[model samples]
Target: MLSQTTNAATQKISPDLPLTAKQAQLVQHILAFTARHLTTAGPAVFALYGDAGTGKSVVLAHLFNQIQVAARTQDASPFAHTENYFLVNHPEILKVYREIAGEHPHLLKKDFQRPTSLINQMAKDTVHPDVLVIDEAHLLLSQADHYNNFYGDNQLQSLLTTAKVIIVVFDETQVLRMKSFWTEARLEKLIAPYPHETYRLTHQFRMQASDKLVRWINDFTHQHLHPLPTDVGANYDLRVFDDAEQMRQAVVRRNQEVGLSRIVSTSGYPSTLDGGKHYITEGEFHLPWDQYNYTSTPWAELPQTINEVGSIYTCQGFDLNYVGIILGPPVSLDEHDHLAIHLDRYTDVEAFKKRADLTDPTELVHIKQQLILNSINVLMKRGVKGLYLYAHDARLRHYLQQRAL
Candidate 1:
């Protein structure tokens, strides 16, 4: 029997699910922090930092559930009768969280909301939540985005002023847009004046790949392309294809066998927000970009999405059984055998929007390049069991194919 890839058990967040030892310990620490800062002066911030698939979201889900349970059930609990909300900026991720809330009695659907919605609602109602948990905090807008209806200078700063306690999960490598651009220094500077605690989660929980393989991916995304390890695919399925068509065929077969396998690409082909389909064509392999998902189900979970090419917007913060990644035109290998990012070839206009706060030409170029690489990093790590690769540039394709052998 073929396994279901996007079932509720796999994608939904459950508070009752058991955590690893380190995760459990972190939950205890967060509870203690909340207790100590509940009655203290200013807002208290607890920042959880981790890479993609480091189980940061799971920690936040479990911690939030515990807080809500205590607040509603135990009169003597420190969080008794306290109002709290869980916020995420991604619509797809917010859908998953809201669906999970329906399964649990303590977690209400209204408790999970987008950051902008929560901010606007709290201001309109003139109410302050006792605690606010933000998932994918890196996606929060740092600058005013009138298109998103966020008129505030910064989402995090606005939330800090409205909530007594705030918990945020952040991964700097996953920052993909200029408007939400952030670094450790920027984040630290913002919360320096407030009472805060920061914790870093380093364990790898999503991918079954070996440590050496993980290191190779890290090196590649950092602009260095080294030869693959001898044991690269011993524990995980890793391959590089000379033809994009062949890679797509492999992804289809994997999806039929194990399900949840889909092809994704970087931003170099034609794409827009005009509500029309734009295709990503590579030789004989062609597919439209992922369509706007209008249902409550996530794009990856929908059966029809397999025929489309997934992007960072739809696939980020989600896992797959196997992933076929087409390294788009913007990614190439330089004469020095290093990965090069071509900004001119990138087609994702929203990701490259000019930020008024940033004007240095050199810094602007560097930030754009990093964001391009960051998108690749996000796509490369989506597979839980396997990863396939294809490149649009001939030199990079040959390099990867030769290294695979």
Candidate 2:
């Protein structure tokens, strides 16, 4: 069984839960920022920047809960009687937030919505919320996505027009889709006109790995593969398997020992949204991609998801006790002994959808490669207690095994 602190279903925003000193201080700062700008003319932006597993979501959850509680219950509070909404683009994450909402009186499930849904609904109602908190703001569509029912040029710009104060948690590395692509420069340019404050959380609150190991993962994600740290698995369970099946077996053992362990992969293999099982087959390892989750429960929390290989879609922003990562065909080692990303081997077509504003061929290739590497980075950082790895490319696999010794 998963511990209370590590369990996804329970480790959510709660009014009674205590925050870390740093998290509390940041929440207070945001509260003060919202109060100072509530009566201002334009939208005020409070941008919280952090990497995955830096307790970013928890901070948002706590901050939003405080906002709602003050608005609904505390008459003397500056946020009293203000309308607010919490938005996230990913469906799986939105589900988790909505489920968290159900347990609290001030938090309503309706208050938590997809970014596109909230934008369209607010426009239709001709109402502007006083406060809007966005989790996974990187997932917001940077361009108009008609298929997702967001016709606005930029979701953030649209939300800025519809809200008095907007609080967003962003991480550039977690940007997965072309439609939702974001960078520090682009984000800074967009918010230049607004009254905004930015804060970056640097602490690694999710992974139990040492700083050296964390640096190793960061270096690997940036196309630099160095030898593993000498004490790689001393404090955290780190392993590189030559065989994919063996890695899966190790992950299974970890799951049986401690819940919330699962295998995840980067973009490769046959994957599509056709409502059929797309198997990821290695030499002796075979498992289907994570099916579309119909229930409100987060995908990683489901007991049966242990049998499925989670992709970026289902696993982002969630924690696991142990993660077995399959560095797919897109990931390999080049002649210079550096990690190389092959765009052709990347099977997630949605991630590479063309954007009209981005037309330079060289720039497009760079962005695609970066996004692929970003997915690997996200998967690698999912494991709170341990991380296991297997590469599809023979040379890359050999390189990792030799370096991990």
Q: Write the per-residue lDDT of candidate 2 for residues 214-325, one digit (tens) a residue.
A: 8888888788778988675555899989889999999988888888899999888999889999999999999999999998788888888889999999888888889999
TM-score of 1: 0.97
CA shift of 87, model 2, Å: 0.7
lDDT of 1 by residue, 1-405 (tens): 134555543353567678988889999999999889999988999999999888998999999999999989999999999999999999988888888888788889999988899889888985579999999999999999999999998999999987889999999999999989998889999999999999999888888888788788887878877898767656589999988899999998988988888899999999999999999998899899999999998888888888999999999998888999999999998888888899999999999898789999999999999999999999999998899999999999998888786
Candidate 1 deviates by what RMSD?
Answer: 1.4
lDDT computed for candidate 1: 0.89
Minimal lDDT window, size 10, model 2: 1-10
Model 1: colliding residue pairs: none
